[model samples]
Target: MLALPAESVSEADVIAGILALMRERTGYDFSSYRAQTIRRRIRNRMISVGIHTLTDYLVHLKSVETEALELLDRLTVKVSHFYRNAHTFDMLREEVLPGLYRRFGGPLRIWSVGCARGEEPYTLALLLEAAGIPGTVLATDIDEAALRAARRGIYLRDALRELPESLIGTGLEPVPGDERHVRVRPALRRRVHFQVHDVTGTALPLGTTDFHMISYRNVLIYLQREVQERTLLQMRAVLRDGGCLCLGEAEWPPPSVACSLSPLPQRSRLFEAIAAEPIA
Candidate 1:
């Protein structure tokens, strides 16, 4: 087993080493995530593995191949609920989506980046269905396991708490003999495709200038400022002219990308791509 210096290495050094090793070994980069989020995840993983010291954790991470993947999962923890902010979905359903469909014309395409366990994409599918629009959703996440669970299309009752009542019977069906759980109806699930994608990587899913809408809510808050700016730029490049970009209520396009995006009137976190304007 390779070793990091136990006596002299500070927690920050050991954490940086762990992150670097993870990038080298697993091909996933967590180095661009905020330091505090990284530290908290590392500490959580240490507790899980019964390693109290950061130096020891680094040594253990180097020796165990599975530990790297485990730690990656910890660092990219995916926690979300269906219709996470009820008001956001309400706005999408009542205002944003219909306009996009009308403007873009048939077969509306939506991308749900960092879609976590699939709630966001499935929620979109439900909205499309309710609006009687012909559309498909592409859901992507860096975590393969999360995508696997998403493909399964199942959720517990609590996860559906914020799900609008009208959608409950239409979008989800109860699992056999499992009252506490429900699965996205097969018909609705058919409208969403899940893939493993890392936002930090160079490639953009589907290609540039493609999607009519991109819902990247809540994921940016954890990334570094540089990464956040890069991601917002990517969103700008891929979104069609006048396409909508939905962010978490607390999030906004960084100044660098703000010129390419204009906030919609009365919408909390919704922005429209100014695709034709020079982003100066």
Candidate 2:
């Protein structure tokens, strides 16, 4: 029997070592993530890949680049749906987009940070179509695999479960001879671009373009608090004055960032960016 070191025997110690390895190899910090969540996810990944020990897994990460990518993908959560949180989409359609449409004088540039499999951006394309507005959506995610799938623009039949029926075929095409697959239409795909990015990194590409609205919904909750704050500042930099920034309903910005934003009257999760002394 191989004897592991007494110092590395405890589960806590093992998890810490694994985390350090992850940060070192990826350069994306996750030290502030919820410990229980990361622990559970990595443990699950280990078991699935037949990695019996955390120490062994650390060794595996160094040798296998694909495993590292898979580990990163597993660590991040990517739950999204078209017209997700329908009330929120309803708010965007009824109130938010029109407000931006007037301010930007027609074509609106929107950002969907941490966009997984391109649901939100494609949804935005459909919404803009319905509203009779020209718009472009830049969708980004940290997972390269997810971004590849997003670019492919095909989804399972069940993926449209929450989307309204009338809005379905307008921006998406069902795969021929296959009932289970749907592809985002060529015209709609043209309006959205997908990119790979790690939001925790210092060099996130928000482009030089000023965005009228950003849909960063649900992604920040998984990050460490400091990361969440840094992400807010990054988004603040590219957001045009008076642009909209929508976060998950359960989320809150760091106190310093909160001062620079004003909440929408009907929705507290949504904020309108306003000028404040920039944080360095």
> Quick one: best TM-score, which candidate?
1
lDDT of 1 at 195: 83
* lDDT of residue 262 for candidate 1: 86
lDDT of each: 0.87, 0.82
lDDT tens per residue, model 1, 1-280: 2233657767778788998999898788888889999988988998899887788898899899789889988988788988888988888899899988888886888999999999899999999988899999999999988999999989989998899889888789999999989999987888999888888777887543588999998889899999999988888888887888999988987777887788888757888888545555
Give the RMSD in angstroms, all C-alphas superposed, for model 1: 3.0
TM-score of 1: 0.93
- Tens digits of per-residue lDDT for model 2, 1-280: 2235566377667777777777777666677676778877887888888877777887888788777667887888778878888888888888889889987876899988889988888998888987888988989887777888889989887888888898897888879999889999988988898887777777867463688988888888787778889889888888888999888888878877876788888854788988875555
The segments of candidate 1 whose C-alpha lies over 4 angstroms from its true place after superposition are: 1-6, 207-209, 275-280
The TM-score obtained by model 2 is: 0.88
